[model samples]
Target: MASNPGPLTNWPWQKLGNVKYMVLSPFVANSLYSIMSKEERERDVTILYIYPFFLWRMLHSQLWISFARYQTSKTNHRIVVDKGIEFEQVDRERNWDDHIILSGIIGYIAVMYLPWAARMPMWRWDGLVLTILLHTGPVEFLYYWFHRALHHHFLYSRYHSHHHLSIVTEPITSVTHPFGEIIVYYMLFSIPILAMFCTGTASVSGIVGYITYIDFMNYMGHCNFELVPKWVFNNFPILKYFMYTPSFHSLHHTKFRTNYSLFMPLYDYIYGTMDMSSDKLYETSLKGRKETPDVVHLTHQTTLQSFYHLPPAIASLASKPYSPNWYMWMLWPIPYGFMFLTWVFGSTFTVERNVFDKLRMQTWVIPRFSFHYSSSRQKDAINGLIEKAILEAESEGVKVMSLGLLNQGEIFNGNGELYLQKHPKLKIRIVDGSSLAVAVILHSIPQEAKQVLLIGNLSKVSCAVSKDLCRRGIQVAVACKNDFYKLKLQLPTELCSNLIFSTSHTHKFWLVGDGGVQRDEAQRRALEGTHFIPCSQFPLAKARKDCIYYSTSAMIIPKALQNVYSCENWLPRRVMSAWRVAAIVHALEGWDAHECGDSMLDVEKVWLASLRHGFLPMVAP
Candidate 1:
């Protein structure tokens, strides 16, 4: 259960246990036996062998819990929670003691078969050498097949799923499994001995080393931190062909169905289960030590918005307190309205960069928060859910959390200022990443164009954008629901000189407002043009290739808000800019948010921040 975990490799008694298990278990048992009488010696010697193995497991689990609890390389999200769609941790923990006892018995049974009288030790270096060869060959190959079988839906539901419940693995997590799966695995390890004895190559010395080495490597695989330094594999290129590191196996636990080979990479490469991201994840882990982030970003889809993403969560909602009222389910046909029934819940999906860790990023998804939102009262409830996300990030030692898309409404904007004012003790800072995205959109606007058509030009953001374009030596045409300026006489000199009043499409580069209704037929016709930026002023209009595309939404770590409320909305740029900006802010917040100057012309510094921190667009090579 890992009831209480320490830091990685920080167990006070682990190295002592490892030394006793590997180098002295047999000798210790002999010393204890020689001191006893014959009858007692025989009775206790077998039991003595089990003690070292048991101690090793205890040490391994303790260290693993530490590694999992204090993962510095990346965040490790708990796969099993007390109450949620995920399997419950309590249910798994309840049977932990029994599992250890059964594993001990199985360990005793396996070791008892090896004859102690003719045991070989490393003094006969040949025995130790052969053991390594035999274990990695037959044992690793067979275990790969065995593990793949466990992933089958039938076996998984009954036996193997429990092990997978902890996606972010701790060292003890390597050994935690259903009794049936554990028993089957114990039997699999026995196959190496059976093969060696059958082939007349069995040596007790080799068996001892093999047992110790295999378990040690297994513990290393589940530590959830990369222990192998880059030089070991990079300088000695041949080792890369054979070795599997903690980052390698951790990916198996995470993405699953990849990197199934243990102890060696050879088999995984030969087989088809290796993940392309395995090496990248390893190098990322090796390089991810620059900064410690004090914040994380969270995003979600509303009920009607996330209706498709809700079946599994909703089906299991009956067991959770946040289940929707029956009436909400009745409105299922209405996507937006039905969302009112759901509550927000999310998990850290993966660890990203430490801000300047090569500037690469990691992310987590806050899948939901009480689904109903939009109305003034419902918005209040949504705000509470927003606080829940902030608190989660705060608990995770996150210093800052960035709001993206619908997460930052007009009332909820400004980096969750209300949250900080109300929850004075909560240390997490709120950031709206759009400051950078809007900067990008403003910076990216084509100043070379002389004429531009503006749709829903009366909207606040769009109106500001239009006036700014007029000031930038470009002609601006404004369309609005109500004619704000009837003629040139009514407009300011700067805008009236370049701007043309129009209720119809002008076919110039369009910067459409996110909202406001006017000349419905004209707007529809304007959308089909070869060049047009869609109705979102917040992400800004800076596209030329196509009329419709999803907004990239940010300057740094751009994100595509395509699945939920924003999916129907098109982005001017293909990549998700909003997510990128949020990703950048979440990764590290060493700079001041005040640097995002309000004036579009004064955005060079902010634009440089975007470029320096990877907030720029993903242009083709």
Candidate 2:
């Protein structure tokens, strides 16, 4: 949206939501029908090519998006410097495919209304040559001047500013524009195609080739990386006048007053609108710069669908917390294919990059899942991946690395302590975040409660919560006798009096941990209005409608946390796991000690420090 919105700014089918693709159903059905019913010679080849061409364009854009993200994550030829992309930009650009849909509709109309368009030849060299000539002479010139006029206050505020909102550009940023503005652009670009038709030189290949060239140049210029080698320009000096680099268009976004040419820089050079620092920025970006983080959070995929929920996979799905749906099962094969790829050829990769009060932070994912950690044979491989990530973080000068999800499982890596034993002199601190997880669970318990039931597996977090509650003079009843005896052994003589063994389901509050089938059975046994607060990393399934289910241990991040567009696993937007937040608090406070492997920090101290650092506790539903 722009500062001052104008009429016709919204796409006509904007309200259709996901079903907006239905607009193309008619054309697709007709094309398929034509192919099946008409004779080979009688069928309109151009019309039949519309749906497939649309699919190709989509795949082409997606490849650019994935490639650009992968390249920028590496320390090579990145044009943007340390700038983070925000949620607003992601939401605004979510509709980038609308232009392709518009083009499909226009093509369908042209084929039905124009006599020559329905019978265009398959190939024509003359049409391709004419398209190049017209685009360079008229399309490029008109677009340059039209672009300048859009920067004028009236049009800028109402429309063009929407595209400029993203200072750190991505490949899709090129097609992100107001519906009204894009319509005018379509008119200008149509000059070449319409002229070819008028001159009786139009062909199916010529039209398709022209559109593909536009997509390539648009993505290349806006990709925010200098991939055009200097050797190309040096060998052919005249190419500089006809071509523009990513750095050239990048300046137009940052400086906002120059480099207004289309794909060709000829107009900008002739009109004196090119930025003077374009060459310097190009050279500097080509050399690239490395980014070292202050904190690194180590996590892994939970379920197979989580692969698609990753930030780079799909922007809209990543922005929301993931939940299983019946429709998602339709795409089961995709996740299976990705799982096989990761098992065979995957290593640790960066999932997200963030900033907090000038502190650089990144989330690095280990290429494994929960089920892999459970397997006896896969344990060493999972541990190896974790150890490798820790060493890499240390090499990158990271101050703290926190383990999240099953990455810190006791049976797998002894809650991330195995790395410390292997590399005893490591500088980077290891944090399993048990102290903060305990804090969140303790704070969630009601002060008026006299007693609470502790059920499921007893882990470091559950034990810590039990000790804290007993110190507050609250009775902690253990549901399982084995878990009760194990927990009692860890407590001092004084706190043992507060611990009780019981199998009753009368308790209104239950602190649960990991148990698959048994956990669900316990929920059925609990009384109405019982509040089940999860002390584990994974959330619990709500089995009874009468009972209350709270989220797993997590906290709402401070407003100052930058670039938080994607959700962290099952956690909601801006809500981070306590384990991840613990490392961030540790780095901000400059804590030197490692908080893993049976070593526990002060529960109250860690909780207060988290509050002082602006991490708010999640309010219960």
Candidate 3:
């Protein structure tokens, strides 16, 4: 330790090559926020961690609630009540202090000295963006599934049902989960960390952005009144396929089994669990309509599922993969600690998620590396993971499952093929969802477009885009890497143009790309005055404001999820691959009601399908 001890010696290793990219890393930054050395930063980790969630909540929570109260006081929007249930004193009281304290306590433990889960904040814009992007997939998939899990007989009776206590909601209800439910939710946020570790680092702003996003969504969802202007959804109905409204969430609070989505309504729309009541409720709330909501208590077993089960707290622990880690020890004491903390802090604590029969639990860590990045041995690990997952599925007797994202590639490239060859007894059929997803992307296209500008690797889904448009006699302007002559040879001469950008008044343009020189060019051109359809998983930067941009991301959202915010990221996962499977399934099943299949896809068919399925129930996006 004494051999070369100094600032330089203590420094994190950095290559000359990497020095240029240090701004990309957390190691170097011109900003004052990153002035402290990392080791010293680690010492301050608890504070760093606390600020984003706990401290931020301290600053903003009361403000939102106060704002809600102020707004409500100013109008009938606050006093109008849901007829489904009467507001109780406990609801307001619980939100005012109980949830806040509980969140603080939980945040303290998670971001504190917990070696396994700690991630300090940083200010890099890229890190923040990467972190936000990384968490999108896992949160949507895991939360949607786990959320459904909470609605199961065992989980709902003891815990998740606690969240449903609000038939009519207020902003405070956003964080008003029981201890058990909150615990699971924190686990969901950790997905970004897992992603960060795999991608080599995390971003402070990214986590902050994600939290801000989810909490804002949570608050918006719980806010009793729908604040969206009816004219916006009516004038630009295409925007409705972007996300949930306060009324959409309010309906879920009352209906219980419907609207079980976390980030976007994609999962619900694809899975067909979207409650038809959402739009009407949203309109009712926005119009300042209110009625008493039915306060009928719904147990998961009785109201949703028929299976009798253990209490959720018990089920959560018993089902957890065995771990004798510090999380468990720290977790078991949380209940007692929570009470003590509440008593000491003088904040009231509710006994909602405290199921006595249950034990403390922790989510098993699953790294996102195999899915996000490729590696030497990661190939084997992915195969093994897939095999294990299949075995788990087989144990559960699930007959069919989709191999999503990276796993779909595992079917052909890695040991995934060997498993299929050797494990003949593993009768579960594995389906790749991208083909159907391509169909869905095709389906999301607008019918009125006479021409399409296709970007990115004009292969796979992009190729499908070319084919789809070409089949419909739509001119295709493709921007990709292949030699234009060679690509021209592969495609019909009449269908494509090497000049990727068109100055001519093309009726419509479609843009899609992954990171490359082509993507940059496409993005640049996209900023031009073209009515470009965004068909990527991520939102394009600096898109045109005046013209409409329909995204494949739109397919995941129901037309009812009215977007109230002006920040025009209508489809959040437009940059990430979150809902391709749902869109694929919906497209194949004619869930959008236009005839589509694996053999071929056409833009016109999809555009017509959009009309048929009411994909663009409104006018513009």
- The global C-alpha lDDT for each of the candidates, from Candidate 1 onward, is 0.52, 0.88, 0.46
lDDT of candidate 3 over 162-247, digit per residue (tens): 55665656576677555456656777876775666456455556555666777777777676666767888889776565566777
What does the lDDT read for residue 283 in candidate 1? 81
Relative to the unseen true structure, what is the C-alpha lDDT of residue 221 in candidate 2, on a scale of 0 to 100? 93
Per-residue lDDT tens digits for candidate 1, residues 1-621, read 222221221222233532323433454455466547556435434445556666665555544543543353343322221111122432343233343455455545454454542332324455455556666777778888888877777666666666777665546567666545656666767666566655556664555556666667877887666778888976999898677888888888777788878678777788878889888888877665544345454555434424433211222221122223554566466554323334323233322222333343333334343233345666665567677767767775665566655565544443356676677676555665544545555555655667777765343234445556667767777665353464344457656778776666645476655554333444455545434554342433333333543333333233321111112122322234443454454444455332111222233454565566545554311
Lowest summed-lDDT stretch of 10 residues in model 3? 294-303
Model 3 spans > 4 angstroms off: 1-53, 73-121, 230-241, 289-621
lDDT of 2: 0.88
Task: Return the candidate ranking by lDDT, descending.
Answer: 2, 1, 3
What is the Å distance of residue 53 in model 2 from its true position?
1.4
Per-prediction TM-score to the true structure, in the order listed: 0.44, 0.96, 0.37
Candidate that would win on lDDT = 2
Predicted candidate 2 versus true structure: per-residue lDDT over 1-621, tens digit per residue: 988989889999999998898999887787678778989888777777777888899989877876776666553687864566777788899999999999998888788678979888889999988999999999999999999999999999999999999988889999999999999999999999999999999998999999999999999999888899999899999888899999999999998999999999999899999899988998899877887999999999888778767776666778889887566787799778877887887588886778898788988888776777789998888888889889989998999999999989887788888999999999999999999999999889887788999988888999889988988889999988998988888888998999999989899999888874245676888889998888889888888899888899999999889877789988988999999999999999999999999998998889999999999999987
What's the distance in Å from true for residue 254, model 1?
16
